[model samples]
Target: MAKSKVEYVCTECGDVSPKWAGQCAACKGWN
Candidate 1:
């Protein structure tokens, strides 16, 4: 089976992240 890819999006800045983080890199907002 193929492995599924995961992504995290910031609601405030609409930034795409490969992994989950406490804050967004683009807007510096909490995720």
Candidate 2:
């Protein structure tokens, strides 16, 4: 089987984060 990569993205600003958080760093939107 192939390994899948996981990514954390912000819905409001489309910013990609290294880890998951309650709020987005780029736009300060809730994740």
For residues 1-22, write the lDDT of model 2, one tens digit per residue. Answer: 9977778999999999878998
Model 1 C-alpha lDDT per residue in residues 1-31, reported as the tens digit of each score:
9999999999998999999888999999997
lDDT of candidate 1 at residue 8, scale 0 to 100: 96
Identify the candidate with maximal lDDT: 1
Worst 10-residue lDDT window, candidate 2: 2-11
Candidate 2, which segments miss by more than 4 Å at Cα?
1-5
Task: Report lDDT (Cα) of residue 5, candidate 2.
Answer: 71
Model 2 vs. true fold: TM: 0.70
lDDT of 1: 0.94
What C-alpha lDDT, on a 0 to 100 scale, does residue 18 get in candidate 2?
A: 77
